[model samples]
Every structure is written in C-alpha cells, then in structure tokens.
Target: MRHWRRIAVTLLPLLFALLHVSGVLHLQVLERLESIIYDTRLRATMPGTMDTRITIVDIDERSLERIGQWPWGRDRMARFATELLDRQQVAVLGFDVVFAEPDGSSGLASLQRLAQGPLAASPGFSEQLARLTPELDYDARFAQALQGRPVVLGYYFTSDRDGQARGVLPTPALSRDRLRGKPLRATSWQGHGSNIEVLAKAAPAAGFFNSITDSDGVVRSLPLLAEYQGQYYESLALAMLRVATGYSDLSPLYDAFSEFDHDVLSGVILAKGQSRLLLPVDPNLATLIPYRGPGDVSGGSYRYISASDVLEGRLPEASLKGQLVLVGSTAPGLVDLRVTPVGRTYPGVEAHANLLSAFLDGANVLQPNFAPDFDVLQLVVTGLLLALSLPLLTAGRAVLLSAGVLAGLVGLNLWLYQVQGLVMPLATVLVMALSAFTLNMVYGYFVESRTKRELAALFGTYVPPELVEEMLKEPERYSMDAANQELTVMFCDMRGFTALSEHMEPLQLQAMLNGVFSRLTHIIRSRRQGTIDKYMGDCVMAFWGAPVATPGHAELAVAAALEMTQAVALLNEEHHRQGLPQIGVGIGLNTGTMCVGDMGSDIRRSYTVIGDAVNLGSRLEGLSKTYGVTMVVSDTTRALAPGFIWQELDRVRVKGKAQAVTIYTPVGTEAEPLAPERQQRLATWQQLLAAYRAQEWDACTLLLRNLHAAEPGNILYSLYAGRVEALRVLPFQPDWDGATQFDTK
Candidate 1:
C-alpha cells in the first residue's frame, strides 16, 4: 500500500501525457516542439543534390529590373511563353502565378471607350479600330500562346470576403457527385483567385498554388488537392506531375476501413493507360515539401533561368531544351518568397519545383495515418518504464537510465523517418517521460515532511529515532513489521585512516576519527535527512525512503553522499594547513527493493536493511577508488535522480552478480553547463565509445588518439583505449555486449 502511493505519484505524469496524446487535453508546447523537430530531421536527411529535370523561370530581381517590374505587359508574357515553348522546346511548362484581371496594357480599352462615345459617329473610326483590334489585344495574344499547349496555369483559393469569387476556376479534379456524400479532410475554401476566362479556356489544365502555412508560420507543406464549391482541385505541382507523366485520370483513394475512418481519404491515385501513381496526403490533403536543399535561385536545388533572359532569348541556344520549367517570381517586391524548413526567404516557386521533383521521384515524406496510436503507445511504454523503475533507483542512476531511454527513443524516431518516411509524434512522449521522472523525484522530496514533526513531539530523547520512525500511525501505512520496501542504501568508507592511526597516538587517533565521524554523520542526518544504520570501524552505512517514508530517498542519499565528499575535501585542506596526513573518502549508492527492520540477536539488535541491493552498494563504494571518483552509483540509483550531469563510468559484472550493471560518476548539477573544451572532449569520448562497442576498431582507434592528445592525463580514456587495441586484433566474438566482467569486488 505504501509503495502504491509512490507508484501512483510516478504515474501521474504519464497519465497527463496520455491525455494530451488522446486529444482530451491540448499541449501547444508539444505541438510546437514536434514541428521544430520535424523541420530539423527533414533538413538533415534531405538530398541536397540539384535536380536538372525541373527548372524555375525565375522572375528574379534581375529579371524584374531588366523587364521593368512584375505584371510586365501581357505582350511580353506572350513572348515569354512563346520563347520557352516554341524557341527553347521545353518538355512541360507550369505557371506559379495568376492572371485574374484583364491586361489593359495595350490601350485597347481606351480606344474602345472612345469608339463607344465621342468617336461613335466619326467617319471610318470604328472601321479603323476593328482593323487594328487583333494586334492591339494583348490578353488575346497571351491566351493564344497558351492555347492547346501542354501548359498548366496557377491560381489561389480564398476563404475570405463571404466566398466572393473572381474569374473562372479550373476543372475540378474530383467532382461533387464523385464524392457521393462521403467526407474528406481536405483543405476547403469558399472563394478563389483564378485565371481570367480567356486564359483558363486556353490552358488545357490549371491548378491552385496556395501554400499551407503551419501554426509556426512556416510553409512546410502545400495541399496537393483542395476542396472548393463542393469539388476538389489539384495543386499546380500535382497538375504539372500529371501533365509530365501524361496521366489523364485522378481519383480519391478511400481507406478500406471506412467505418472507423469516417469516410476520410487515405490518398489520391492518378492513372492513365497502364501507368499509375499513388500520392499520400494528410487529413488536410497536404503533403510535406521534400525540399532538396535551400530555396532561392542560388539554393542549388534546381536550375533557375531569369524571366527576362527567357523573354529576350539571351542564352545559349537550346540551353533549356528538354527541361520542365515552372514560371514564377522570386523578386522580393513580388512577394513570392516563403519561410520554409530550408530557408527563410525561400522562393515560393522552388517549393513547387521541389514538390514536382518529389512527385516525379516518388519520394514523399508523410505523417503515418496511425501516428496517433503510435504516439500513445510510445508514451505509455516509456512512461511505465520510468515510473516502475525510478522509485527503486538513486538520483544519479535515474538520470542515466532516463537519458538512455531518451536516446533510444530519438534513435528509433530518426530511423523510421529516414528509412520508412514516417513522421510520428515525438515530443509528447518525450515530454511525458521527462515530466514523469521529474515529478517522481519531486514527490519523494516533499512527502513525509510532517512525519518528522510528529515523531519529535511523541518521543523527544527517550526512544531511538528509528523506533519512532515506524509508528504504525493510524490511517497511514507506515509500520515496524518486517516487510519489503523500495529503498536507497549508501556506503561511505574513509581512506588513509589506517595509516593515520599508526602514526598518531591512540588518544589523538580516537579524537580525530570521532570528529570526522561526527561531521560525516551530520551531513547524512541533519543536512540531507538520511537515517544512519551503524558505524563499522572507519565507515558509515545509511539508508533513505525507510520508516519515515521519504519518497525521494535516493536523491536525498545521493545529495548526502556528495556533501560528505566535499566535507572530506575540506578536512584534507585543514590537514594540509596543520601538516597532518590528508584523508580521502569514497561513497557508493544503490536503490532497490530491500527488507528493512529491527533484525539482530537478542543481545544486540539493530534496525538495518538486508538484501542484495545493500550488498551491491558496498561493492560500488569500493569501485570509487578504481574510477578515481568521489562517488560511484549503480545504474538504478543513477536513473532515479534527475537534473544532475553524470559521466558514465562502466558496465561491469561484479563478483557474485551475474547481471552486468552500468555505473556512473556524478559530475555536478545541470545548472552549470560544461565548458566548451570539456564538452568537445566529452563528445569525442562518446563517439569513440560508440565505435568501440560497434567493433569499428579503425575509427575507434583514431578517436582514442585524439582523446589521448587532448586529455593525456585521463586514466579512464587510457583504460578504454587499451581495451580498444586488444579487441582490434581479436577474432570476431558474436556474444560480446560491450560489458566488462570483474572477478573482484
């Protein structure tokens, strides 16, 4: 029952996180973190190579400057399209722009106005105007250039202004009747900014170019299909892909499990002749932009040809021949740049180019439809591991264990992303695991505070502290009966005491040992609130989370251990001043389930813990000297603690213990970040360690040399370096698990 309290407290964080994942609760922070992580992973694994197949006819600053700014007369646009299609002989062309208004650059509207009013009665004026109207109509010329060619025009959809629409929208990819009243989670809008009627009729196909901006205001994806006026329209990129592939049909692919899916679509399929292409989309009918690299004309993802150059034909002959060109603007004044994962000022047209290339290459990264379930599963598993294990571990061991689990989680996520092209939710589970550990530790720290006050009032100086600790208080579960309980045990052994006793007089030695014991005992009891078991010659044994029932016994014990180390250091400093031999201390801590009670012979009974956990703690104390560290904590203890930086010592199978346990040496609290030089060295050492474990002897050896060069005096680095050398020459051992076996305690 007592253990259940701590367990429930530990499980609180996991429960809250589960709620968040289940959508019962919303955590904006988690969502933002997931986005940031997604961006990072996307950028890291993107193939930064250029794709020559798709080119951007960039209406860049240079083009805008040379051509006298954007919306450059429709006559020039006709020339631009003619130059690319007829002169350059490009394979396909798509516009990442719109023509919603009439082109009045030819002064034809003014001439017509005069013919309708003042010049109506003029002699032969209407006749002369009619003769020149064909050449003066610029919009007609532009439309003529696009007519019946393999060109797709771009437009945008808007949900604003009471659904007011402009111009003519392109043919719907999926008509309303095709849906048959089924539901879809596609992006929908009430209004649109489409190409003019003449241009829309002339272009064989057209699609929208509206970008999808995430909550963080980054353009990470664009809708491949969007809903408007009860019909679905394809994106410009999708239209281009279909044109290039010569696919003539588009259909929605519904998830077979429609009853559970509420008629939501799984993806869309395009088929023509014997060829077929499947494009997966999220609930929003959007697909992530698989950016090749950064986005501008200089981003190197795609070749960029200046619009002015394309218009004036100022290039090597047939340079753009056989290329698929997307016409768009990148001039800052044109406002086509977007904030993307690859760059802040990413040219919007390149986004379409990237998408088009992805469509062509069949390499699209998407969030798996089962991501919600996967997220919940990961959160539950990780939370359960931390909750069930942390209570029986010390603070240092808790931190180490949590860190290991976190690393595993991150590695697994990256694997699925790079290999499976799946975007699973990571931050919720990550935050839940971390939060559970933190709250677990915090619960232990604050619990049972009133126990001390009650004990003090009941028995002042008569009863032993241990006896009052387990009062069997009414309605509470604390007791003195022999029973198993999770606990943290400590062993602190004084070094150099034997030599000091030999040199000093018996009376002086007794006084020195007693004084040292007093200081150490004070640290354990008054400072860190621990229960001392007994004094064995020059060593002191203690335990936490016992009769008084401290929830954070491991952390309390570790803090006490750290304080004792500092006390010894101060003692050595005083010894130096007085010309006496300086003494040292080594502390070991372990946390596990143990039977603690008053158990001894009738003549001399005492309260103490008895179990393998206690034995392991003693063994760890002896290892402190081997590692040249003040404290050595078992993996369990290390995992129970949080917020402290730890340096991994080793994984060893101690004598009398078949199971190998990882060990760690505490450095300091996380409040003080490591120096840059130390951080670099630590990073190198970690890399070297990973290589050694993986049996990459060559890389391991090289890294070891670098580590040795940097930290020549580090004994641990030298030790591991020797191990790497020995393994380098050894024959392959399939059973090796990177753990060192020790025959001695």
Candidate 2:
C-alpha cells in the first residue's frame, strides 16, 4: 500500500503535465519556456551560410538620407524597377511593399487642378499638361514599368481596425472550389492591404508578407498560405517560389492517402506537369523559418544592395543577374523590423527571404499533427516508469536512473529533430520527468525520517513544532524535563465571551470561540513563533523561550499580544455588522524566569508552566478591565521590548507575588509615534502619578480632573479621582509607595 501510495504521489506532476499537453491547462510560462528551448535548439544548429540566388534591395538609412525620405516619387520607384529588371537582369523581382493608394508624389494632382480651375485659360497650359500627363502620372509610370514583368508584389493581411480594407487583392492561389468542401485550418485575416487595381493588374501575382508572431512576440514561422473570404492566398515566399518554378498549381497533401485525405494538410504540393515539389506545412499551414544565418549581409545570410546604390547604378552591370531580388526597406523609420530568434531587431522582409531559402533547401522543421497525442503517450510511459521504479531503488541508483531517463529523452528528441526535421514538444515531457524525480526523492527522504516525525508528534504538544524540528537536529540536548529559563508568558482572555455564552447556544458559542482562538493562535505560534501552553475556558496561556531558547522572546510575545488584540477587534467588526455583541480581548505579557517542561499526572501528562511570574501574568490580564486597556505589559516585558511606545499604567502587587511590578499598555510601535495631544496627556499623567506618590493629595486632585477631561469616560482616571477624594480626608503619610495591591488571583 505504501509503495503504491509513493508511486501515486510521484505521478502527481505527470497528471498536470498531461492536462497541459492536452490544452486542458494553459500555462503561459510553459509556453514561454518551450519557445526558449526551441530557440536555443535553432540557434545551436542553424546553417550559417549565405544564399547567393536571392538578393535584397534594401531602402536603408543611406538611401533615405541620400534620396529624400520614404514615399519618394513613384517615378523613382519606377526607375528602380526598370534598373533591376533591365540593367541588373534579375530573373524575378518581388516588392515587399504595398501601393494601396495612388501616388501624388509628382505634383500631377496640383498641375491637373490648376489646369482645370484657376489656370484653365492660361497660355498653352492645357496642351503642355496633356503632353506631360504620361510622364507626370507617377503611379501609371510605375505600373508601366512593372507591366509584363515576372514580379510578385508583397502585401499584408490585418485582423484589426474593424477589418476595413483598401485597394485590390491578387488572385488567390486556391479558390473556395479547390478545397473540395473540406475545411483547412490556416491563418485567417479579416482584411488586407493589397496593391491598387492598376498595379495589381500590371503585376497580377502577389502574396502576403505577414509573419506569424508567437505569444512572446517572436517570428518563428510564416504562413505558407492564408485564408480570406473563403479563398486561400499564398505568402510572399510561396508565391515567389511558384513564379520561379513556372507557376506550379498548388494542392494540399494530407498525411493519409484515403478519400478523406487524413483530414490534415501536411504540406502543399506544387505541380507543373512532370515537375512536382513538396512543401511541408505544420497544422497552421505554416512553415518553420529555417534561418540560414543572421538577417544582415555581414552575417552571410543574403546579399543586401542599397536602393540608392542600385538606382545610381553603383553596382556593375549584371552583378545580380539571374537572382530573385526583393525590394524592401531596412530603415527603422519604415517600421518593418521584427523580433526573431536570431536577433531582436530583425528585418521583417528577411523573414520571408528565410522562408524562401528554406523552401529551396527543403529543410522545413515542424511539429506533426500527432504531437500532442504522442506527448500524452510518452508522458504516461516515462512518468509511470519513474514513478514505480524510483521508490524501489536506493538513492544512488535512483539518481542514476533519473539522469539516464532525462539523457535518453533528450537524445531521442534531438535525434528526431536533427535527422527528420521534426520539432517534437520536449518541454512538457522533460519537466514532468524532472518533477517526478524531485517528488520521489522528497518522499523518500521524508519516509526515511519517520522516526523524527514520530518524536515530533510526541513532543510537539509540549513545545512548538518549529522547536521540535530544531530539537531533532540535536536530540540529546532537548527533552521534556523541566528547565529554568528567562521567558515571556502571556494570558489572553476574551472579555465579552461570558455574555456571549449566556445568550448563544452551545454550538454557536463553541464555533465563535474556536474561530477567535484560531486567529489568535496563528498570531502567537505562526507569526510570533511562540509555543502554546494550553487553552482554559475563554483563556489561552502561551510562553516563549522554552524548549528552544529564544533571546528575543519578550519582543515576540509583545508583538503577538498586539496582533491578538487586533484580531479580536476585527472579529468585533463582523459582530457589529451581524447585530451581535462586539467582543474584546485582554492580553497580559510578563517576562521572568520560569520552569517550562512536560509536567502533569501519569495518564494525562501535558506541557505547562507553573511559577509566580505565570500567575502574575494571569493577574495582569484581570487588571486590563479595571484600567480599561486592551493589553497590559509588565516592567520586565517593557524593558526587554524597547521597540514599542509605552504608556505607563500603574504599579501593582498581585496576590501571589510580594514584590510590586510596574505595568504599561502599549501605545503603539516605534514606527507609529504618539499624537501631540496624547503625548501631552501621557506627560500630564506622569506628573499626576508623581504628585500622588509624593502624598500631595491636593495637587493629585487637580491633575486627575484635567486627565479625566482630556479623555472622557476613562476608567483609570476615574479610579484615581476617587482614590484622591478618599485620600484627601486621611493624613499624609511618608514612606508610601503608589502600588495598587490586589488581594485576589
């Protein structure tokens, strides 16, 4: 039974891992960790080689600085297209840009408006404008340059801003009829920013340049195809590839070859009669970006030719001949930078180029559709194996087994990733295995120390559980035998509990008492680290510095007393809301030498304290009601705990103790200073005590009145006033101490 129990305990992590893998539990940190792992693997194994076949014409900072700011004259753009295609002789040209609106950079609109309105009758203005119209029309001139060229313009899809769209979209790679009534799960967009009708017709082939950003805002993949308005469009890389390969027909290739085709789109099959190529896609109809290197020319990834250099004809003729050229901007002002695994400020255009190269190399890495199901199976097998076996083996063997399991899992995962380009989910399985090993090791250690726990359960009633744990570290030094130590003791009693018990039923009173005790006990034991002696009726007795000698026991007890009073005050708040009587607590703290140990009769031995100081603490608790304060601290406690602001109450001699002890009520901690008026009251009360102790009854009388008036309905002041009035009649006595002697315990 215990073996099975240990196994079950160890399997708890695996249960949660299964839920995480199955999507029943979504942990963002787990996803983030998985991405970090994937990123690390990618960075470690990337091919740092450049692709000479593709080139980037970057509108960089130099180009912007030399040729004026962006949205430059479309005539300039037309010159760029003409130069790259005619002079540079690139095989294919793609613009990682969208011309959604007509360009007015040539000032043709103003010229046309002048010809129509103010300058309509100007000399030769209409005829000259008609002759220069073809040259001044920037968009038309740019479109004419792109006409009949093998160019694929890039656009992007957006799912924001209410899906509002502008301009015209290119013909989709796959129409709704091509889907054969089967649903394909691809990235879907609400709208797109496509090229204008004139440009779209001039270069009819285009693809979206939108990159798929992970939850961590990282571009790890690009959708090979996206869906919009029941039609599927290809990405820039896919379109560029198809144009280079004689415009192949795109078809979905599922995993299985049945009529239903396995219900999974594994990849897209591009066929141009006898020349077929397979483009594998993940579940998102996306391909993982096999980054060749860093996205800069210096990183040996791709050739980056500045737009200004290209337009100025700085490059030798045919320098980039037969290469697929991508026209985009790399300037930060262009807002085309992306956060990617290789670098933080990667170029968005380079992401598409990376995917294009991955297409050419056929080195796509993706998680299969059976990933989650396989993860579940793997988790169960690895989890149960570790859960059941780790318990039977020794510590050394267990460590070895756990280490071996981890190494084996990692080896297999890396093997599959490197050999077959499969990106299996390794985070959850690795984490589950580590958690299982940790839980098993912890359980084993706890089981081996059962004797200590048994001893703790035995002595825990006498001392605190914390003390018991410390005591076990050196068992020979600690025992239940009596020992004398300077400790702080407390006696807390509920003031209105007697009245509550009279009106409430037994069950109700019991519940309220338990609730009150629970809160107060937590403050004393957990917060202050004080050991509870016992509870008697509505009173609880606890002491500090017992089995484990704590030097700051008095300070701990004082803080605990203050919090216990606050807890009762909060209880009274709920009582006031419920229309029940508000309750109060009186806690008394005393510090002195006391005998503490497990002491009782034969069959009912219990830990308790019995000394003059403990009895005096109980006596001080009763004095709280007489003085009308919540807590009373003895001079011993006040002296030890100097971190609190103190208000001197009185000196009193209880029935058991002959020596008179000064007591005080805690005003607040040093962190909370007494207000000005209260400080004055405290100062005046000190003088009143001086007058009364000096046998100056007349002076005491006047001070008592002022003190009572400062605090209306103060019992301590009222008590002193009656004492002075009664003492006024008696003759003044010398050698008199101002200690209020109590006759009862």
TM-score per model over all chains: 0.61, 0.60
CA lDDT of 135 in candidate 2?
Answer: 94
The residue-by-residue lDDT of candidate 1 on 1-745, one tens digit each, is 5445567777887888888888898989888999988899888888889998988988888887788967888899999898888888888899999998999988999999999999999969999999999889999999999998889999999999688899898888888777848757788899998888999999959989999998898999999888886788999999988888888898888765454434667689999988788998876788888899987767788988888888788977778888889999888888988999889988999999998998988888788577888998898899889888987788899889999999999999999887777788888888887888888778666764454464455443323464465443421344345689999999999999988988899999999999999999888876777778899999999998766778888888888887888889899998889888989998999999999876778686666899989889999999888777789999888888876777888788888899999999877777888888888887787787677778899998899889889878777777887888788889878787788887887
Q: State model 2's lDDT.
A: 0.86
| Candidate with best lDDT | 2
Lowest summed lDDT over 10 consecutive residues: which window, candidate 2?
255-264
| Whole-model alpha-carbon lDDT for candidate 1 | 0.84
lDDT of 1 at 240: 88
Clashing pairs in 2: none
